[model samples]
Target: MINPNLALKVLDSPFHHTVIHNFLDLDQASLSLEALAEQEFIPTESDLFSYSASNNLSISDNPDIKSLYDSLCSKAWIRKLESLFDVSLSGNVDMAAYVYMNGDFLLPHDDELDSRLLAYSLHLTPNMTLSDGGSFDFFSSNTEGEAKEIVKQVVPKFNSIVIFKVTPESWHQVSEILSDVQRFSLTGWYHG
Candidate 1:
């Protein structure tokens, strides 16, 4: 379990701040889950659908995957998010593990779930090169148009967890993965 104070610090950091942690054996987990996804799962439009071209694997219904998701949600990290945002989440909050292969990407867009109030993702691949182009880009905008300046660019790394407010203003996307190796991560949203 993560410390609540630490989670608060992560939330209160500057917009789009990137923090790295290496406590979990996410690389091994990623490999195991990736194999499971490849052999036992079927891809759907909801799983792969993004503003840009990308391949995604949804495992919300899998018992093993759901156990992991439940653990994450019960951690102090999630409790801190609730305390910071003053929101209570409920219902069946699902999760998806995305595997971005070479040339796959997700275009800039806000998560559009009415029940969701926060979004979280944990990178599971090891030694991911920043130049591989799977970095997350965050944006800000006004009534005029897309904001000229980029808020931040977060490099995806193993065991790195990113939690953020989810709204129409929180625009973000995963750039195209340029490497042959798959870029894997667990992604989900908190619902109310």
Candidate 2:
């Protein structure tokens, strides 16, 4: 249920990233949303992030979402990502469901990790606008290599996906949710 032909726009300036719309079939997406709705979200708070997230969703009992997660970690999807980012992926992933309720936000930081080669988010917040304030942002660096400010903002759109190369310059953050509605997403890192 994947659309391999969807526009994969690459932005290299602020640490490589690709934005993809219509990432999955409508039916599959609905299954994911249903599974997410049944899961218990735990509050996760840290100096770096504050939000409610499900425990590693890969271990979930929901066959639909689990099957979808398995497919995303398959060789086929890895190849698609490789073609888009022009980098190899080891077919390993760490994923979880996130719910950013009102005022919940993740502070700015590079998702640079030795094991992670790419970071991604499959957004499921439908009908969200910029005014909603729960957007995904990628930060650009100043000439001195310091993270300056956000260069791109991807609004929470249902069934869209965003993937970024995990370099030190891959700093990014989730803006605080201003609206009363929860911002939902299934996010993870592709490891190499």
Candidate 3:
């Protein structure tokens, strides 16, 4: 695993940015879903969009998931976020899986509530095409608080994970899925 300490400089820099790598172990990570029929976790209507005021998925209170969440939190990657954001993360883990079919998309928006301090997403499916429009986009802002430019686009790959500050400035969204294949991922937020 890469030390998240190296990402501190990037996180604290003035420009908005994102980190991408295939290192997270989702098979071992705990999962909870909104749909019971899906077997595997799947995001609800609210979870699929960024504009939703609240998520509809319920996380497992099970110890295994809690242990996995705790282990990941101890990793250098999460520690780097703690240092960069100047916030200590605490409380229960709220997570859900996202499965997008063709034409599915999440509109651009910032995370809400003081409760959600940080956000992370781990991709699980593979063989996705870049042109399929499922990439995550990070935006830059001007002094006046307007979107200045798209600073980066992180392509979704198997085991690829993205961690970012969840303030109003850390604005991001997912493009529409253009392929027939399903796009699967585990998405969640950490509270301070």
Candidate 4:
């Protein structure tokens, strides 16, 4: 469930992004995230990014993780997000668990894709800090439309969620992880 106040904050952002803390039931979400982290992760690598990602997690065997995924796609949840962002979510959500270890990073890019209306990341990292260098950095374009410096950086924190409207100017990246600890999160896109 989303708070109306938080939704308003997201709607009022420069590029329309809102960060929500305690996004889910803390105890239940934590347990599920821990279970999801134990599963096998396939290596996702490219010139633009490097990280480990799981297959579509909606079919997860872990009950808690499955529930979390289900809620994100549920009609009720869709209504909540739609009410806030003014986007018509198709009630179809694609999501997966991701792991970023030291040196893992994603370069800046707009998450432009067919059917995608919003991009989201729910941080499950238990004890990460800014010093860890794995923050979700948001960018704004310059006059000529080139990607500019990061305007906002979100340090991954347990039970926190970041929702960004996926548009041409919505460029963002995951900064390199400097710590040895693994950075964990559930990320996905909601379709229109």
Q: lDDT of each structure?
A: 0.61, 0.85, 0.61, 0.84
Ranking of all candidate structures by their TM-score, best first: 2, 4, 1, 3
Number of colliding residue pairs in each model: 0, 0, 0, 0
- Measured by lDDT, the strongest candidate is 2
Give the Å error, residue 170, model 3: 1.0
Tell me the tens digit of each residue's lDDT in model 2 across 57-176. 877778988888987887888887888788887888999999998889998888887889899899987799988988998888877666799888989799888888987778889998
Question: Between candidates 2 and 4, which one is better according to lDDT?
Answer: 2
Model 3, 39-78: lDDT tens digits are 3443446555621212323444555444445655564546
lDDT by residue (tens digit), candidate 1, 1-192: 332233334443224323546434554455435544453333333443432222333444555555565566674545655776666766345566677777777777777578887777777777888888788777766665443445677888776777677766677788878888667777778787
How big is the RMSD of model 2?
Answer: 1.4
RMSD for each of the candidates? 4.5, 1.4, 5.0, 2.0
Q: Of models 1 and 3, which has the larger TM-score?
A: 1
Pick the TM-score winner.
2
Checking candidate 2 for backbone clashes, the offending pairs are none
10 residues in a row with least lDDT, candidate 3: 29-38
TM-score of each: 0.73, 0.94, 0.71, 0.92
Better of 1 and 4 by TM-score: 4
Candidate 1: give the clashing pairs: none
The 10-residue segment of model 1 with minimum total lDDT is: 48-57
Model 1 stretches astray by more than 4 angstroms? 1-8, 11-20, 23-64, 75-77, 144-149
